[model samples]
Target: MSNDPLLDELRAHEEQVWDALVRGDADLDASLLCQSFLGVYGDGFADKSAHVGQLAEGATVQSYALTDLRARALGSDHAMLSYRARFMRHRRNQAEDMYVTSIWQRTEGGWINIFSQDTAAGEATD
Candidate 1:
């Protein structure tokens, strides 16, 4: 087995999260989100259930493409991940993109996402 425990753990958790989002896995989504999670949406903040419920509703997240994914350790128990997600909204029949940042903390039950913020990649204005 490898020795870099921190890096190995972080990598594993990151993959778990990304896979969940891409596959629209409600169980994994709920499991990874902290009970006190604060998610900053396009314009406001939502609690843990409110955020995860969106995924659990099975509202057809047709294709979530992640790019420029990177993770950095923030002290001993926290990690920050940044990435851009390009996804299609099946309900609206539209394509959308956003820049996302998620902060995760190692908890007794494993890794849980404590904070998340997403900004829409809007069209440039001249």
Candidate 2:
């Protein structure tokens, strides 16, 4: 990892978002997501609050982990991140391992996640 605090902050922001999702913390989700944030799911898109609102209802991430994380600074106020994630949703008895890309924008307060896209690493067939 570079000695760049901005990159560190960006990773922290990403972790916070996942943690908030797992914990179903609406306040944390609200704090981390931007007003213009967009979460691009495979089926469709969701705005910031509405997306987090789902988490607040009953969704909980059982375990979440990020690996192979790398970050690039796009100008001064924006950063891009790529990583592999492994997570489980206990309620659905579902698990996912995927590659994720996220874009973060700096705000007056701190770094906030503005966009996210993920692709699933499907199960192997033999």
Candidate 3:
């Protein structure tokens, strides 16, 4: 695995987003996701505006965190972050944990999440 500080740096960015989500800070979330951000989830797909729009429209995320983080640099200007994300949404019956991979591209300002896909981790066999 690549032991680059970029991993931690991006991880911190991801945490910042989690904080923003829980707080329903759409501006913060907007700053982190790219203009063309695309999120692929179980229900459907969402674009950048639509993604943050939820928070802007009063959607609430109770809490969230990422674990087992691993990042791979895609050339010099991009990286892929893989981890297990656990989070709870407001009014939801229960929390959900999913395996997630987010693609971030480094730009003049900084890194912005450009794409993300979530895969549900089914019940443990053991």
Top-TM-score candidate index: 3
**Model 2: per-residue lDDT, tens digit, 1-126?**
568776677778888888887888888988988899998877788898777888757547888888888889998898999988999975767778998899998889988889999888778799
Q: Each candidate: how many clashes?
A: 0, 0, 0
lDDT accuracy of residue 21 in candidate 3:
80
lDDT per model vs. reference: 0.76, 0.84, 0.88
Sliding window of 10 residues with minimal summed lDDT for model 2: 1-10
Q: Write the per-residue lDDT of candidate 3 for residues 1-120, one digit (tens) a residue.
A: 247798888898788878888888999999999988999999999999888988965648787878899998999999999999888988797989899899999999998999999999
Tell me each candidate's TM-score.
0.76, 0.87, 0.91
**Preferred candidate (lDDT higher): 1 or 2:** 2
Q: What does candidate 2 score on TM?
A: 0.87
lDDT of 3 at 11: 92
lDDT (Cα, tens digit) per residue for candidate 1, span 1-126: 136565456556756766665676778877888889899987688987786677765645656676777778898889887878788865667889899888989878888889989999988689
What alpha-carbon RMSD in Å does predicted model 3 have with respect to the real structure?
2.2
Question: Which residue pairs show collisions in model 1?
Answer: none
Q: What value of lDDT does candidate 3 attain over all alpha carbons?
A: 0.88
